[model samples]
Target chain A: MHVTSSVRPPLITGGKTYADVTEDICRQVEGKPTKEWKIAFTISVIVLAYGTACLFWTWWEGLGVWGLNKTVGWAWDITNFVWWVGIGHAGTLISAILLLFRQKWRTSINRAAEAMTIFAVLCAASFILMHMGRPWLAYWALPLPNAFGSLWVNFNSPLVWDVFAISTYFSVSLVFWYIGLIPDLATIRDRAQNKVSRYIYGTLAMGWNGSAKTWARYEYISLILAGLSTPLVLSVHTIVSMDFATSVIPGWHTTIFPPYFVAGAIFSGFAMVQNLMLITRVVYRLEDYITLEHIESMNKVITLTGSIVGVAYLTEFFIAWYSGVEYESYAFINRATGPYWWAYWTMMTCNVISPQLFWSRSIRRSVTWTFFISVIVNIGMWFERFVIIVTSLHRDYLPSSWAMFSPTMYDIGDYIFSFGFFFTLFLLFSKYLPVINMAEVKSVIRSSSEKLPAKVAGVAKGERVANPTFNKDAE
Target chain B: MADLHGKYLVGVYDDDEVILHAISKIRKAGVKISEVYSPFAIHGMDEALGHSRTRIGIAAFMFGVTGCICALCLTIWTMGIDWPMIVGGKDPISIPNYIPVTFELTVLFTAFGMVGTFLVTNNLGPGVNPNMFDPRSTDNKFVMAIELGKNKLTEEQISQVLKDSGAEEVNIKQF
Candidate 1:
């Protein structure tokens, strides 16, 4: 709202104008590396190396290198897979889904979240690719002619749909991410001082000269793509849910999986965004552009989606008891009071119970509290998948096959390697990509010009907005 | 210059009220109009200029239909026609199975169709860039116009009409 030209606030106050925003965003390349970057780079590389080492050993050793008994076949690997994939949901959800809704707040965070989606999916895929004992023959999943059993892949199977879903999801998100990056890359190309930086950034700029026709069509195509991607994002997680729901694995079987899974994905993804943004906002000296208001807005989404996940949790317990089948009943009871009750309650406390604190304004507005909750929520979600995968399998139909699963050093290494995989991609993104959509963020700086002040005043009180929050209620 | 026969008196403005006032004034004065343009499109500007709702959306739908047919034909040619097999408990022509490819083709066709139609209708394509008025028109200004000869309006009358309607500046150009 502040429109002054030359009265720039310190980076900490974050009261930057358009030109200031441009300069601040470009600061990473314009300025040489500081001590802080060195520290961050050092830590990321160390952890990343550990992660890679863990991955190499697992690939060399085999599937049994980690831990997956017949009972708990999914265990930590699938849990990590689902969790990483879930973490990916928030990015596209924020970018595509929110764009369709025209949520202006998304502009500040979408590029980073989209990057997160790409990286997190890469991490999740690494786990999937590695988990394949015969990594070379993973093509058995594809619908190639003359493959095994003279057959096309079963469309009925969620796993088959997932191959399509994940691949489509990856390409769609990648294209969307790349297209969005074009203008920002041009901005960087124009701003770069060094010859090497200019050449690399200039090529990636794709010859964009901010042509009016291109911008108009760019806006149009972005809208259409967002519309297309919105359903794709939902379908992806829904199909992912079908992976579990299609089976009769007690806690995994439920109609609630799609929405619940989508919500949890957003919740964890927002947390990861919070984690990354908090660090970036601090380190990059971009407090004004990535303001507390932006963080608060994201925190609001986290709170709301987290509670949505909370309700899904309660509904699962309610439905399990209501079904009146002993296996289902015991499944619910087993998750709570079984041998892995600690894991179950940990999931509950982290995912369901902790997010409720957001109902209070004090906590949601506090960066320190939000960052802590974001981490806890992510942990809870990972454990949530773990609890679902393990508890159900540990006591499926007979006690004879029941076994407690533990991650060997191999399991730990693969997990670490996935982390390495995630951070390595993330570090590259942070260095190279726009990191935030400068054009979109610039458009957002002026706020919605058409909004009647009376309508916007209502937002201060924190009134709950309906899904697809637009003129439906306001008008 | 052969394409310049349909000369347009495109009036550009900033305020919505001025554009509305100008359009009404021109219509009352018995002047036929062409089109209104803006940086970010303004709602109700079409109605002011008496433009029809575009068939671009309809064209998109038709393109989508074409895409579905193409998808079906291709699937049939591949799965049913060329290399038919009966591995699962399903027919090759099942629409449920065709959805993924169908949806993609539909989008691809519709998008390409819209772009093609937009370019053709607007008289633009490869190696053709139209003359621009104010540089800022595409940034935050609004534009309105009529095909000059169709309305039988003189340049002076148009200028007066534009000034009365709150146009900051007015000009005539051939592309």
Candidate 2:
């Protein structure tokens, strides 16, 4: 039986029945796109068009259009890559980790979050391709055998590990998200009035009849996927961090990179989720499904992960001095007081100091504050990666070779391209798909809904047996 | 496409808990249930229908094992046995360095394998028309279908049993 604590606020308000859940979630998919959606879509497409042109010219001109010097080979490309990849982590965390934890609130937001993961990874992968001077030779990164050579991709290289990690993560996340969508798609299919809509949704639904045996197997497979994904998500960022950590650079070669990067990933990821979801909740009028409780719960996660990232930053600094290596110590000192100190301090203020505001219950629950800070956290996270990659390389060993890096229009445009691509995909998904997991939410209605009478609510306080069939009128 | 051909008695209920209780009652009355469909998965309905636990987890484990083995073989065969080359000043057969790729491939194989097995076993795939008892079953209704050929009870008797066991509506469905 479904059981939830009485002290906790109702996960679903408005006393939604199974039919209401279906109606509320499916309305967006079945109905016409709103004016706001049209406007947003137009803007995103325009940005995507301009950015694509810049990206095409960058590739056509052979990476010379961007500001990459001999001293600093990596710049906004790798930074944006890590930043977008980190943003993708929140989706898996909400879907897989929260599923394992049995968080019922995740039912409302997990679909959109997981979609975000897929699109964010696509944006991140775009950066990888853009960074590769010859995008056609990108397959060389894979471990495919060549007809002319005995050299396989180096298994010892973290870059090779990244190829495997990212591809696996993308495919697995896509499968998991699609599997979860089948039942909901069937719901929409069954309700569709138009023949074409019915046929399209019917195909996507895959003939899901909701048989008891199939449901049993479906639940089991979902659990197994979640189990596999937890470690997979952690491993992805760990491997990504190892790309730098395994290097011999004084600031990059640190033992703490794995945990540090993972925490930072979840931190930035939650902030991105907050930003997208807050807008989605308002634009779609999904305040009932994505309630204030969900917002507060996600804010708490942002706080916890943000704190871990803060500690990691300080720990890196202390260790730099504690290691007594002059190069390592100088790297940390230069990061705080170097020419790129604005970026470093911006990272500190946005990521470390900003999320601390969530400690106040009001601020955590306030939509305005949450949205504002989420934007700040995203900016800070981008700078965090920029600081690590650029500062470490900009002033490496020899003074004669040291140089400051600046981004040309191409670098800025490529970064904007990701934003354009991500928003374009997300807007389409929200417009055409059920943003909430209807079946999962319906299952919890008996236990977590606010339709219980006063007496039943009192009885259910601090105890089980909340009476599953309490609200006959609700059905 | 004509996987199901049957004349059946369909019982519709609104609440999951009520249908769950009705399943045991109807079965106790000696009527065999062909299937029960609902918008959401009803807990304990499988046990109430006397279905044993599914073995998809076992398949998942086996797939995971296969993935692990394949990853290990790929790394070892390519890095060590095929062409031994020293990269990053490490051994060609370094297992520690192989851990990340090995772990990733294991998860990838397990996820794809398990989902493939699940879809295949459920007879679910794109463009497959579902054998539906009631359209509302996907909306708000819990539909219990009893194949007339499998059940020993008369249609009238089965309808009465369904009505008495809390089915809001009972009807005959032919496919």
Candidate 3:
């Protein structure tokens, strides 16, 4: 059944020691890159250079240089924004939310996912700034109140709301991620082989030592932050959804957006995780740490969220049809049967149908097959945004306002450049930072003993339980 | 250094089931466990550990309420008191009209307030680093710690107590 390989830590029958896990992860940094890394890095650099040149050109010109007319004011810019933001959501979801839920399986991939979130958000913000026609005047989006005195900025605009939400999310996620990195950085510092490595690692470590007392407060604060970050993570996407929901656009103004967008964000985020993890596990031979069981768990989330998004899709259609507003009805109908029907169906097949395969045990566990499906999930999400944005806007209230829209090479270039920006940061993370949470992995190993008596009071298997130990010696 | 001897308590378990079991035994033994240590997060440990429902939600409620109030004040001051511009055929302070701004204020203030509250409650900011123990505590281990008061035994007695309670390794710290 290949179930054994799926359980991973391959032959963890005796359970892997903490030292083994640390040694396994540290091997990548301690050794030279495999042949594949050299090739991949070279390609990424070239692509990154292309992306930089595109950005320079975009800045030299104006947002009008792209194909965005007044009809499709957002075009690839907002699509890329939402896409990258969606990509970033999985980071805090995996690290912060999963930590709050006490999901043991999350430890394997949370570090990498959080790194991806930071990079993806950076990419997303680049789009936002670049899309600002007058990039120098982008501060108008902030709440500084126009200096030229064109009346104080409305406090109610979702566009302004997006500024706070995205910025807060970026900062909070960065803090959450860095706090988790402290001990692992110390681990690298302690074990570093060279003077330069030691100096760099030490600075990042911020003088951490393994004392039991400090750990007490650290644990308390982490729990609190996890609590804080869970809602914050949820809020980031909810606010992002409001960016569309508050708008009077035919397809955008729906109550279903918050939950639907949240689900889709997670769905796409996990898909990206799968994409990166699959290649990483294969290339770095970290299948032991990033196991098939972990993939299955993530696939389960992807599938569940995908199904929720599917319901949202159908619900929007149903609501629009039932509302009997011709414009609204036209939006859905045009999406499904119009010239861009290919985009809509592609969204459905990739995001909705591809994930449904996880309903089967076999499909979810097959590493190779899951990787293929993850690509489909990514493509589906990107197309879904395109369908939602372009289809609804191409034709508005009157037939006289209708016009067909197609992305020019400029549009395509800007979209592709986001990938360049995303990967460049990602490659840097892979090269420098500890991609896995080493401390957490060690703790997992320490607590994996089977000899202890079974069945304590009310502690569930694999769930986050509070600490329960009293000192009789004190009493 | 501080003198907090023999007061700290911890129960160690190898697996989740044992963690739950040890929790039961420890509770039954009338020994208030300062902490429970495990390799992974076992479910329901918070209830087992005697932790209160954290005030984070309450703080969020307060933050959200503050936002609503701020929105009200800002609208009253800016639109009602200041030069009222009747641009959209509506009163500035009207409920229907004020909703969008109110909502935005609610989000903005709640988000910022929650962040500030969180930072303060956690005792986090620049130049204030908390002491650390077992660098591994936040990593892979699920631990519950309780620092003891004045009454306590010798390190050997405490060590024996922890070892009997299934602690894999029992140690002491005087701070």
Q: Evaluated with lDDT, which candidate comes out highest?
A: 2
Off by over 4 Å in 1: A1-15, A147-150, A448-475, B1-175
- The alpha-carbon interface RMSD of model 2 comes to 3.5
- What Cα-based lDDT does every candidate model obtain? 0.70, 0.91, 0.69
Q: What is candidate 3's CAPRI-style docking category based on DockQ?
A: incorrect
- Superposed by TM-score, candidate 2 places the C-alpha of residue A216 at a distance from the truth, in angstroms, of 0.7
Q: For residues A246-339, could you state the per-residue lDDT of candidate 3 as single tens digits?
A: 8899998889998999899999999999999888777777777777778989999999999999999999999999999877898999999998
The Cα error of candidate 2 at residue A272, in Å, is 0.8
RMSD to true structure for each model, in Å: 8.0, 3.3, 6.6
lDDT of 1 at B140: 41
Candidate 1 lDDT by residue in tens digits, A1-475: 1122223211123333344556667777556767876676777788878877777777777787777877777777888889899999888888988888866667778888999998888888777787777678788777666646365555445776677677667767787787788667766766777898877776776554443344555566667667767877787788778889978878888999999999988899999999999887787766666666677778888888888998998999999999887788898898899889999899989988888887777887788998899899999999988888888888868878888999998778778777867776777677667677777765544332222133442221112221222223223
Candidate maximizing TM-score: 2
lDDT tens digits by residue: candidate 2, A11-77: 8888777788889899999999999999999999999998999899999998989999999999999
Proportion of native contacts kept per candidate: 0.01, 0.85, 0.03
Order of candidates by lDDT, top first?
Answer: 2, 1, 3
**Complex DockQ per candidate:** 0.10, 0.62, 0.12
- Candidate 3 C-alpha error for residue B77, in Å: 5.3
1 or 3, greater by DockQ: 3
